[model samples]
Target chain A: MDLLEVKDLKTYFYTYEGTVKALEGVSFSVGNRKTMGLVGETGCGKSVTALSITRLIPDPPGKIIAGSVLFKKKDLLKVSDEEIRAIRGKDISMIFQEPKSALNPVYTIGDQIAENVLLHDEDLKNLSKKEKKREAWAKSIEALRVVGIAEPERIARSYPHELSGGMCQRSMIALAMVCNPSLLIADEPTTALDVTIQAQILELMKDLIKKFDSSVLLITHNLGVVAETCDDVAVMYAGKIIEKGNVREVFKEPLHPYTKGLMEAIPSVEKRKEALKSIPGSVPNLINPPSGCRFHPRCPYVKEICKEKEPELFDGRVACWLYGGAR
Target chain B: MKLRDYIARRLLLLIPTIIGVTLVTFLLTNLMPGNPVRLLLGERAASPETIAALEAQYGLDRPLYIRYFVYLRNLFMGDLGMAIHTPFPVSTEIMARLPATIELGVTALVLATIVGIAVGIISAVRSNRLSDHVSRVFALTGVSMPVFWLGLMLLLLFYYRLGWLPGMGRLSVSIGLEHITGLHTIDAILTGNLTAFVDAVKHLILPAFCLSWLEMAMIMRITRSSMLEVIRQDYIRTARSKGLRERVVIYRHALRNAMIPTITIVGLSVGALLGGAVLTETVFAWPGIGSFMVESISFKDIPVVLGITVVLAFANIFSNLIVDILYGVLDPRVRYG
Candidate 1:
């Protein structure tokens, strides 16, 4: 059975403009210990998909219209708030994008990390004050050690505001992975980082995956990062995943027209002076997206059928509409 | 600037600011339409020679600027000069009255802080519950009712109508004045005179309530709103998700941050409380600085009035400086600069 399966995930944001269909009929799955990279353009429901899984959708403006995120053999949508909270940072921890803003400024990094351990560890119940403090100390240090922070003892005393951005990000990851969660959702974790720092963080995450023996759902708009770290890839355009397959297969075949366009757009060091390929038009408005395929407007292989009826993801899908139809 | 530097700068700025305050207060008190001599003369006695000699004696016969110079000289030398008709130094009169005002102010502040913070935290914690609604209504009534009117109503209801408490004064004038520290309550405690203590506390209840009600309401509203805003931050969610319980989230995490703005308001309002206590002092006949200012105004004793204004301004400036210093302590991100 798949470790995490999202079936027809639909998260809509109610705005004064209109109910933005952020994630419409989105489906994907991540296997145990398999890193799945979710690639998409900005505002294409990528973050919303991750937020929906955790049920962190902000109220009033955002709502999960429909979805079933099956994690550990249970639909997350059906779980009560208390249960979901238990699952969070314990069963499935998430690493947010901006480290600086994500961590509370007032708290020491030690306290923030100890929160996960304190919340999940049953032994902590009715713990003596001394015992609890000792446990907290051990957990905080252990988390810091795994995240590559030397002198964990001294660093634990430091506050979030005192730490550097990279240090803060590492601390956040340390907190998330402290529980050794089965699945890690890294939503654009490296986007806020510099390119060199991004590579370092990517390597660190990859190392953490091996160390923790957990699967990762790497959400990013960067195809290059996907190539480096992801094993399986999902290409999302507008509000739907246009194509998906093993990373090597998807990169080699360049199946979807949109996928092919994204690949062609990357500047290769090998190519001496090839002019970068630019997609013709902007992404369609999500409030009133085009009737059929969201990418068809910009698809080089756009056909009459592509504009009329949306093509579902076919087996080992390719750009050709001939395959998108009934086998 | 470091927090220290910012505070020092503010304190330094206060010197000139207070001097300016002294000037304005001095001028304004003198500028009032009524004449102190006429008020003192009781509407019956009048002689031009008497008026001229009294004017010369008090130096009111001199130019306004000359009078200001002498006033400043006497003020700097710590002589608040003398009351227009009396030989008693204005400083002595103020010193005598100071304890009464301080007693009333301290009691009122303590009452305000305790009742306001209690109502605020309760309202915030139980938002929309019976306690919250009752407190909200209490705050609304407190804010809307004028302090003088509140005092009168309270005096009538509690003293006249209910006969539950004394209506006025710090202590019964029938009890001979006892000296040490001047606060009747403290002196009673020192002397182990439990009866005096009870009498003093009885005398304090109505006037203190009159002084504190509006301030209490203001604090409650501020604290409630700040707490609400703090409770919504992402850290609050993080704290709750840690399963630390609602008390930890509300009291520990949210209340700490919420207190930053509340502290600022509290400081400024302390100064405002002193200013607004005039009517409370008057209605209760408390003989505090507020009542003293009213009397001085009625007598048109500009020097005494101006002297009190300057002291009040210093208190305000000093409180604000303390508040600015507290802001840094509460939020480290708020640097001196």
Candidate 2:
């Protein structure tokens, strides 16, 4: 069985203009110790999908209308808030895009990591305050060590502002890994770092994932990052995933026109092209998205039927007219 | 950026600020039309010989620069000169009344800060809810109402109609509790006099509430907006994702960051409360520096007015410095260089 399975997740944001269908019937699964990359352009509901799994969408403005996020055979979406909270940092943890802003500025790195450690640690419930603190401190240092940080003790004591971008990202990874969660959601984790630091962070995450044997839902727009680290890829356009397959399979033969465009858009050193290929139009405004295929407006090989009827995900590959609705 | 060096630099900067304040106060008070000598002695008693003698005694006959230097020298020598309207040292009068003002000001500050922060947090947490709407309306009313008017209304309602509180003064005439701290409540506590303490508190309630109402509203509005801004920050989301309790996420993660600006407002409001105390004290008949200043201002008592202005300026500056230090404490990113 998969470690986590999300089926038909739908999330919307009710704004003054209209209801924005941020994630419309999004579905995916992560197997044990496997990494699945959700690649999409900006505002394609990748982040919203991650937030939905944790039930972290801010209400009144945003709400998850329908979804079933199953973790360890338990439907997380159906659980009470308290139950989901208990499962959050323990069973599933998430690291964010901007590491610098992700950590509380006022707290020392150690204190923040220790906060997570203490919160999920049941054994510390009965311990004295000082004892719990000491245990948390020790665990935080250990977690920091796992993320390849040097002098974990000192780094933990330093505030987030005192650390470099790469160091802060390392600390974020340490925070997420401290609980040895079964599943980890990384939302554009290295997007804010420099190229060198980005590579280092991705390398560190890869190492940590191997050591912890945790399934990962890696959300990013960088296909290179997906190819380097992810075992499987799910391509999202507008607010829906248009394609999914093994990383090599998707890269070698991308079926969806959106997926093909994304692959061609990457600036290749070998080709030395004068201009990198880019999709013709921008993503649709989610408030009033395209009626059928979200990528229909941008799709190069658009057919009449494509504009009127939405495609369904077929056997192991895509949701497009080219697939001929074959199972 | 070291904390010690930063504090020393801030302290050094205060020297020039204090001097500037004193110089401005001296010049402005001296430049005013009314003469302290003429005001001291009434129109009926004023004679050229008496006026000249009084001018010479007070050094008002000296050049403007010379008089300013003399004022500074006397100020440095711990002498605030004498009150023209009253036969008492200006410093002595201020000292006698300073505690009353401090007690009222501090009580109002503490009450407003605690209650304002609580209400503000609730409003921000449940933004647009009924509680938020209620607090916003309350804040609107508080900001619009004048301090003196509020004090009078409270006095009329509680003291006259309800008969639940005292009408005026720090203590009732019958409560002869010896002055320990010059703060009735503290003195009462020190002497183990519960009745005196109760009477002192009763007299304090209406005035302190009136003084703090505007400040409370300002604090609540600032805190609510600050919290609303901070609660949307990425760290707040990170905190929530950590599986922290909603209260922990709101208070520990969101509120701490929100407090930086609110602390600044609190410090500024203390200075505002001192200014408001002039009206609040008059309406409640509370004997404090504000009331003393009000009386001195009417009589055109330059020495007393200047003395009070200098003290208030120092209070404002020092409180601001304290708030800066608190900023460093609350947010490690704020380092003084």
Candidate 3:
């Protein structure tokens, strides 16, 4: 069984303006030790899907309105708060987009990491306060060392504001990976970093995934990152997943017109052009999205049926009338 | 080392701040109507020779600058001069009443901080809900209600009507504890007089609550807004995602970040309270520096007023210094500078 199987997840944001249908029946499965890249443009619900998996969506505004997030055959949506809390940072941990902001400004890197270690590590449950702290501190330093942070002791003692962006991101990765979670969710983990640091963080993440043998649900808009780091890819448009398959197969074949447009839009040294090809129009507002196929507005091969009815996953890979009739 | 240097700089700055306060207070008190000598002498004040002789004896006959310089010199020597109406020195009179005021102020501050932070967190967590609305209304009433009216209302309810607690003074006439600290509650505890201690506490409740009500409301409003801002931050989400219990996330992760503004308000309230909760003290008939200071002002007793002003200035500066130190402790970024 897959490590995480998100079945027909529907998330919505109840804003003052209107109800935003952020995620509409989004579904995907991340296999054991596999990295699944959820790729899309901004506001396409990539991050929302990641948050929904762990039930981390801010409740007042955003809610996982429907569907089951089955982790290891257990429905995460159905679990009690305490049960889910135990699972989080132990069974499934998440890394966020902005590393510096994501870290508590008042605490030292060591203190923050040690906090998680103490919270989730069951062996230290019965230990005395002093012993637990010592163990947690030791584990925190080790976690930082694993993330290639030099002078882990000194770095651990330093607060988030004292560190550089790359350092903060490294600390964030250390915090997430410290408990050896089975599923690691990285939501644009390298987006706020320098280009070189971005590459470094991705490499470190790839290495850590292999070392921990953990599955990753990597959410990003950068297709290059997916091509380099992910084995499986799920391309999302607006609030729906348009295509899903092995990275190599999807990149080579590019069945969905939107996917083809996204690939063409990528800047390449070999095929230089006066201008890059972009998909027509922007991502639709999910509140009042177009009927049937969400990509039909921008798709080159739009059919009469595409405007009338939504297409189901054909062969459980692509969702378009080109693949098959609307199910 | 850095912290030590920062504290030293702050202490050095206190000199100028205190001098400024003294200068303003000195000018204001000296300019007020009514001669202290006449007030002190009473009916005998009608005799000019006695008034002049008494004024000369106290060095009040000197020119303004000379008297100011003389006052400053004596202040440095810890001689706060003589109280106009009393035989004891101004310092002695102030010292006698200092503990009573501090005991009430400290109790009120503690009550405000605990209740304020707790309700603030509750309101922020359940924002816009029925409980949040209720707390908001409670805070609004606390802020808007007149302290004297509130104090009287409390006394009327708890003391006169319900007859459950004492209404005025620190303790009953019969209940006397050893004068260790001069604060009845502490002295009672020190002497192991449980009954006196209980009596002191009952006497304390109404006035302390009245004194703290405004401070509590101010702190709650600050904490609520700060917590609301902090609750939306990425770190809070990070803390939650780290599998920490919600209590730990809200209290440990969120509260610390939210406390900077709340601390500022608390520091200000402490200074205000310690400077003498005049209205609260007056309404409760509590024998604190507040009533004493008010009396000195009416009598135009310059020395006693100056002595109280110096204490007030110190209280404000000291609270501010404590607030700065707390900022460093709460945020490392502030410590380095």
Which scores higher on TM-score, 1 or 3? 3
Candidate 1 residue lDDT tens string, B190-254 = 98888888899999988988899998998898888888777667666555534455676677777
**Model 2 interface DockQ:** 0.84
Residues A1-327 of candidate 1 have per-residue lDDT tens digits of 889999999988888899789899889999999999999888888998887887877665788888799998999999987788788778888887888767766567887888778778777889987898789779889889888998887778777777777888888888888888899999898999888888888999999999989999999999999999999999988889888989999999877888888998888888848887778898888899988778877877678988888888888454347566743
**Which RMSD values do the candidates have, in order?**
5.2, 1.9, 2.7
How should the candidates be ordered by TM-score, best one leading? 2, 3, 1
Which portions of model 2 miss their true places by more than 4 Å? A122-127, B45-47, B160-163
Question: Model 1, residue B90: what's the lDDT?
Answer: 84
* Docking category of candidate 1: incorrect
Clashing pairs in 2: A110-A156
Candidate that beats the other on lDDT, 1 or 3, i.e. the better one: 3
* Stretches > 4 Å off in candidate 1: A122-127, A150-154, A269-277, A280-289, A296-300, A304-308, A316-322, B1-81, B85-251, B279-287, B335-337
Candidate DockQ values, in order, are 0.22, 0.84, 0.78
Off by over 4 Å in 3: A122-128, A269-273, A297-302, B1-9, B31-56, B60-69, B160-163
Which digits, one per residue and each the tens of the lDDT, describe model 3 over residues B135-179?
899999999988878988998998899999887888899976789
All models: lDDT? 0.83, 0.91, 0.91
Clashes of each: 0, 1, 0
